[model samples]
Target chain A: MSDPDRVLLCYCTCPNPASAQHLAETLVRESLAACVNRIAGIQSTYRWKGEVTSDSEELLLIKTTAGQFEALKERLLAVHPYELPELIAVPVERGHAAYLEWVRAAGGD
Target chain B: MSDPDRVLLCYCTCPNPASAQHLAETLVRESLAACVNRIAGIQSTYRWKGEVTSDSEELLLIKTTAGQFEALKERLLAVHPYELPELIAVPVERGHAAYLEWVRAAGGD
Candidate 1:
């Protein structure tokens, strides 16, 4: 059984579907994530250089473990288009036991 | 200034867009959430009753605070359709200060 506390759900936004899919596949294929769920049709509103900006973006919910976060972040940044991408990890307080295990195994840690 | 540690990003999934939108709006309008971002076209794969299942779902990225989590959870459960809804709160380790404040004010605490 995987430690639930170590499980993380990292959130990031992509400019388009192709890039999102590519990133998701790369993460999963490289075992950096157990699974990557790409959510389409999201509008992000935020501040950029003192101005409020909105953009249509695809969100990537990357499932991995805390142990792998550092490496995952490095790899994501290397390929990501944004200068400052949203790489926030929210700890998974609780989840299905089997599903959590799958995440651990997929992350290869 | 709102303490960063008190902020939370709650994650949940709905069967469709309307319910997700309704829940999101209700949370924001009722001051239970600062803002709710809905992402459409997500596929969730998990196990249920010893069987693996996959479903098309919409994900809700709910921004709130730790101080209001309990009430938020109660309200979410009351209106949520699932018998066992996925209400997971992930701590926001870091974020843009201004954006974080927006979340806090929107959640009303």
Candidate 2:
């Protein structure tokens, strides 16, 4: 299997559907990403300002290469409404050759 | 030094927050994961019925050992309202010794 480039997996969440869709399409259409998988129905529990809080949020798993990450972050923040967009990147170790190829074809610089 | 059993990563989403939290708790309370990191703001796109469709989904990265996966899958489905819960398991190659140790300690049969 042709090893896929170690993908940078980014995570994010939105309170409303419009912002979620908007960010996803913008990332994909611009070719900064090979693919963008949006997931919803997240109940988040965490400490904010030293107080425990819980909220319903939608999470996004973004797939891109390491090279484009900085720019991707900039783009996400430019449009994202949240005070702190959950932008974390993980490395893709391996994947089915065909699937990774599809990702590469889908990506744009 | 101890080796943490290779973890199984399961991805999921809930249309509503209740389902998300409910499913998460069931899995964790039963000790299916060392930890469940909840995130939000996801916008997903995929092809369904020959048409490209998109929606918001909260992807749950359920961290557990490889052995508990079968049971984990069963429990997630039992509590999950979705027809097909997005349950995909990926292996952990390496991790910090202390963190993996916590995972092992957190596991339950």
Candidate 3:
């Protein structure tokens, strides 16, 4: 059995290239993340004003340990600009041995 | 420049399809996320034991507004089995207006 509290996935997005780099560095310096993967060109869809719409966006995948979640969130809250910033985590059920251990070591101070 | 305080990206992962579906449902039902995009066949590379290793994994791309983030995380933590879940958030600076509005409405109870 895996401890839900042990690992975390920090998902984020930015309008441009600049903010993405800024946030990634902030998380790392604060010891809230081990690595940040910045991916460009993501298309998204949602309903607004009773209408469905879509747009292009950038995505960031942050890898960190569970223990650092709270602090990571705080750092994010302090700098993000949306009325409600997005922050969601998924439980990692199973994975390859080397990757799991890599995550453990990388997401540490 | 945009305010570094609004919008967020929530990222998480699971070892298989079943867990991914479960978490996506949990987030949507709880209104922490408006939608979850489940993508299969992600190849990951990382270093462990001072050596680089790689593997294939599944990916979950979740979309939710800022307000729903914390609650969404709580729900994910409640059911995840991993010692650490992947949770990362990025700021949304510029995007299609329709999509932004949609995110705001869908992420609410």
Candidate 4:
């Protein structure tokens, strides 16, 4: 079914590991995400406020189903520390069936 | 344009940072991807060969347009160390117009 493929891998960046871990735990505890992978040692380069900027940031890869996206985004915005956090969703095209099911179940279906 | 929206954020895991850096550089130099973010300290848990397995792996968040996905996958497969690597693609739903354009241009669009 398309349901599993509709699972999303959401990406966001945090200023530090503490905030990143806090957000990740909250999302998983609230069932907004099945799992959240916190990645450290990421150097991001981008343009901000008319200037080219770069930062050492932690990245959060949040996994949840499409149906939960809106709620997840709302919660993320409410707690995220950034003025304009990078909240991007990408569809999971394929994966192991059991693992995908585990993700769905973790997101509280 | 739709082309920019068609940009992808491909995710994969490598055994170590050296392999990850090698792949990332190769992808960029070959124009298969606009950028690749290497994140260390990733803990991946999944079922493998009838058992659940976990590993500390480096995650590669690869950015490229949709058109380059096939070639990128092919190149990745040819060089990846895993017997069955996790090659997943997620469509970028939204991003800064300028940044998205930069990604497309980097992918050789």
Candidate 5:
């Protein structure tokens, strides 16, 4: 099981700005994320179904607490356009204390 | 100690396109990173030195292996202009297998 209070930076990619924006808003509105940074115009290259595919995708850096990850993942997989969306959570080992505390509180219980 | 073979996503921010591009190129060229995705025009808000600050910055999503992290961190701190640059390494628990392999191989031993 994931830790309940650890700060996490979850990385997710969307096909375009519309989807990215929608997802970001949903996460924040639901208090599943403290904040979401949308970075547009990223080119991703990876292997898919035995072929190397490259495409333009927008990246979402979602900030939340670990306890929210499961719910966040569920919401993402349910609403995301991709059949298999990438949701990778990386722990925040060190960050500004005040900022991290804000994230934990803003992320909700 | 970190797991040397694990794939890692290192989050970093640059003040502008020139710096972001330069840092990305250097990391890839030096094998400190397998790939670096430059996302321009991001706004970051955080608490710094007892004050809350917000700034427009470019984000660098660096892909490398844990083995290269220390060297990568050293290089980033040495070259990054900020008195204290943010270098957060998030371990990749899951990824496309081939892509992860590419990262580990390209990141060097």
Candidate 6:
């Protein structure tokens, strides 16, 4: 079994399907992520500057290992349109072993 | 600042939108989760009965506290349709402070 902390699920939001698909494909193709799931039509409310605003956004659930995170983040920033995109990484505590292994293996060093 | 591990982003999949909405609303109403983001139209490939299968599933991105996780998991297990639902908790390492605080405050003790 892999160390739970080794795997990460990174959360990021994109303005549309085009950007979302591009980012997801980039991560997987570059071996920076095992898989990326795009969740569409989400309403996100956040305080930007001084006002609270809500926007329709697409969420990308990027699955990768800790070792691949820095590179992943760098790649995301290079292509993502937002000046400061939301990139939060959450560490997995426990998961289905087989699936976890698949995730770990998918990101080749 | 909240301990990074204090906030959990639980991942769970539902067969359809109705079940996903039900689960998300239940957790928020019961104060077990601060919020739940339902991601519709996801393709999940997994192994079942020694065979690989892919299914269209809705993914729930549940935000809650470590303090509320036990109760949250219990409620999820009781209400989730699948005999064995995927309830994986991932600990947030970092996030926008205000957003993280909002997540913490939404769940009343």
Q: Per-residue CA lDDT of candidate 6, range B1-109, in tens?
A: 3453378878888999999999999999988888899878975544344343446789898998876777788898889998767677777778999988888887765
lDDT (Cα atoms) of all candidates against the true structure: 0.78, 0.67, 0.66, 0.78, 0.81, 0.80
lDDT for A62 in candidate 3 is 83
lDDT per residue (tens digit) for residues B1-109 in model 5:
8789898888899998788877877777677887677777889999989999999998888888889999999999988989989889768865445556777877653
Tens digits of per-residue lDDT for model 4 on A1-109?
Answer: 2453378878888889999999999999999899999878785544334343446789898999887787888898889898667677777778999999888888674
Off by over 4 Å in 1: A1-5, B1-7, B10-89, B93-109
Model 5 residue pairs with clashes: none
Candidate 4 vs. true structure, TM-score? 0.59
Candidate rank order under TM-score: 5, 6, 4, 1, 2, 3
lDDT of each residue in B13-92, candidate 1, tens digit only: 99997888778766766778765677788899999999999999988888788878888899999989999999997677
Window of ten residues with lowest summed lDDT in model 4 chain B: B94-103
Residue B50, candidate 2: Cα error in Å is: 14
- Whole-structure CA lDDT of model 5: 0.81
Per-residue error (Å), model 5, residue A104: 1.4
Q: Candidate 6's residue-wise lDDT over A1-109, tens digit each?
A: 4553388888899999888878887777777887676777889999989999999998888888887888899999999999999999877875555556767777764
> What's chain A's TM-score in each predicted model?
0.91, 0.85, 0.78, 0.92, 0.95, 0.91
Scored against the true structure, residue A8 in model 6 reaches a CA lDDT of 86
Predicted complex 1: CAPRI docking category: incorrect
Give the 10-residue window scoring lowest on summed lDDT in candidate 5 chain B. B93-102
What does the lDDT read for residue B19 in candidate 3? 79
When candidate 1 is compared with the true two-chain complex, its DockQ is 0.22
Model-by-model DockQ, in order: 0.22, 0.17, 0.06, 0.22, 0.19, 0.21
Candidate 5 lDDT, A1-109, residue by residue in tens: 6668888888888999999999999999999999999988985544344343456789899998878887888888878998657677777889999999999999765
The share of true interface contacts that also appear in candidate 5 amounts to: 0.25
Specify the CAPRI tier of model 4: incorrect
lDDT of 2 by residue, A1-102 (tens): 223455556778877667877888777767666556755666899899999999987666776766677778899999899898788876554333444455
Rank the models by lDDT, top first: 5, 6, 4, 1, 2, 3
